[model samples]
Target: MSTTPQRLMLTRTDGSPISALVVDDEAVLAEMVSMALRYEGWTVTTAGDGASAIAAARECRPDIVILDVMLPDLSGLEVLLRLRKLNPALPVLMLTAKDSVEDRIAGLTAGGDDYVTKPFSIEEVVLRLRALLRRAGITTDDGDSQLVVGDLVLDEDSHEVARDGESVTLTSTEFELLRFLMHNPKRVLSKAQILDRVWDYDFGGRSNIVELYISYLRRKIDDGREPMIHTVRGAGYVLKPAR
Candidate 1:
């Protein structure tokens, strides 16, 4: 008897699986992007024009969208408008060959969450999708790996974090650092400990990079809230859920 292998899937906060729709006119490029995203474990679908892009999104109920700005049927901006109407909070990553500031502004103004100029690396595309998903308050996990301390929730599978149910965005580095701190909640992590675990490098006791990122995380994760990250003066930092 032959057995079938199971493919891993990413899920959102509500325990539903995450899916993505890739809209591009180039067949080769669309397949390549779909494969890359699927490798990350997201359900991936593709469409070559505006009408089909909208149709696919409606049919699939995707969690995010990757849209190419230049489409054979309609402009990317126009497609975004239609998609936004379908799902106001849908995160869209715009792809374009144009590198002008104006072009980027137009996309952003039209509800695109991010943009990548053409000839870009698929690695970067995947990373951007992760960040987009993070901002959208979604992540991948087996439903058991999600970390919750008070109102703060961090899903290891999705690499997503939310404090007090408010979505917080973090850079790639910042996200890693926050994850490290959250994993050891209420544990006084010395700067050395943090540096080792988060950066994997010995800064020879002379680097303030830890301080910088900690401050960055505080602004995003703690500012205007009952401080969760507390400094121990001479000791280190600790993440406490106390409000």
Candidate 2:
């Protein structure tokens, strides 16, 4: 069975919906990235060239910009300079088809906050944007910053997890996986879904990684308490409040 990817509904620190500007000469890629950002509950604006990007940045004052290194008019570096002049603190994640280290350095040296090579997964783009947002001090609203299922609690902002009043230590990957499960408590999540959401890429038939992480979570979350994470016969894993 397939399930629609869940919307994160993250917001700006000021409690407003986060906004983003996507600048790519490739119309399809721009729209695809914009759609993913919008799915994350962000207001997104797309520009096909450097000129439109600058104009949009001035008008929208987006919280972040997903910039394409290659633009039809001015180079992405030039656009980055213009954008910095408008809002020096605005976070920018550069997208480049070039995977060369020098190319990456050029983008970073030109004041880009982060960079992702092309042919990337949408999940990777989303994950990188979230990290950039957090670093820029834009994060979930206070009311929506944590997830709770029964005795388990996960703090999105603090990256802390606790169960039954006891704090549980989790690695970054583990935290993300648990957070995904917590978001859809009681619903079965297939390994493919878990891989996409947590790893941000296809694992090429390697599902044991999910199993490994699930076992790690169980040891910490279910050890000496009723289990909350359970696997169905041949379906997937589900999290439920311990009965």
Candidate 3:
């Protein structure tokens, strides 16, 4: 039961044309979405299938992408996996007709930034796009920049991490999880909360992915050092400066 923070409203003064790519098997739907996005003054591109979506993404390097779950050639999840390997920071919004918790979880696990159900309002889609763009630091009011706690730091812009003057390398998922924890430091975050915030709607509480990744983070940030992330009995996990 993962959910994002909800829609965002942006003013016309945000400036610059945000580039986007839409991948869906439906031509009419794609064109319609493109037109709406264009109306917002964004540069939009379309790909009818997964393979072409990947190709367009590589060539275009869009700031955001709207990926439909069902594609004629490849599943949207498969396309997402490929896209993540190609560009981990690419913000992807997944569109699907299925609204089951399982379906949502699967989409999140595939590396989506947000999820929008089919037959949705165009305004809702625009809002989600704006929210993702804002989170990625492409908005006018705020920027992603770098996040830090004590000696540990997560550089959102450079995708790098360091603590106590030592470099730490983490996988993309690990980095995302750590960043979420750092962003919400000292807040008791349940597995559900972590899943929602870090993985978006597509990750249903399927497996021990969060626990496994927490262990990974501990190894890097806490093992053989002053502990920063701690587990509260029957509660959840918390990250804070070592006491």
Highest-scoring model, lDDT: 2
Clashing residue pairs found in predicted model 2? none
Q: How many collisions per candidate?
A: 3, 0, 5
Q: After superposing candidate 1, which stretches have Cα over 4 Å from the reference?
A: 1-9, 140-243
Mind giving the per-residue lDDT tens digits that candidate 3 earns over 1-243? 111211222332356578899999899999989998987778888999999999999998888899999999999999999989888988999999998889888998879988988877674587678778777777653333556677777776567988777899999889888877876777888888787666765355563778889999999988788998898877889888765
For all predicted structures, in order, the TM-scores are: 0.55, 0.77, 0.53
* Models sorted by TM-score, best on top: 2, 1, 3
Give lDDT tens digits, candidate 2, residues 1-243.
Answer: 112222347788777889999999998888889888887788999999999999999999999999999999999999999999999999999999999999899999999999999888786687778878877887853434567888888877678899988999999999989988987888999999999888877779999999999999999999999999999868899998887
Runs in model 2 deviating more than 4 A are 1-16, 118-140, 143-145, 156-158, 200-206
* TM-score computed on alpha carbons, candidate 2: 0.77
Overall lDDT per candidate, in order of appearance: 0.83, 0.87, 0.80
Model 3 TM-score, 2 decimals: 0.53
Show pairs that collide, candidate 3: 104-202, 105-202, 105-203, 105-204, 108-202
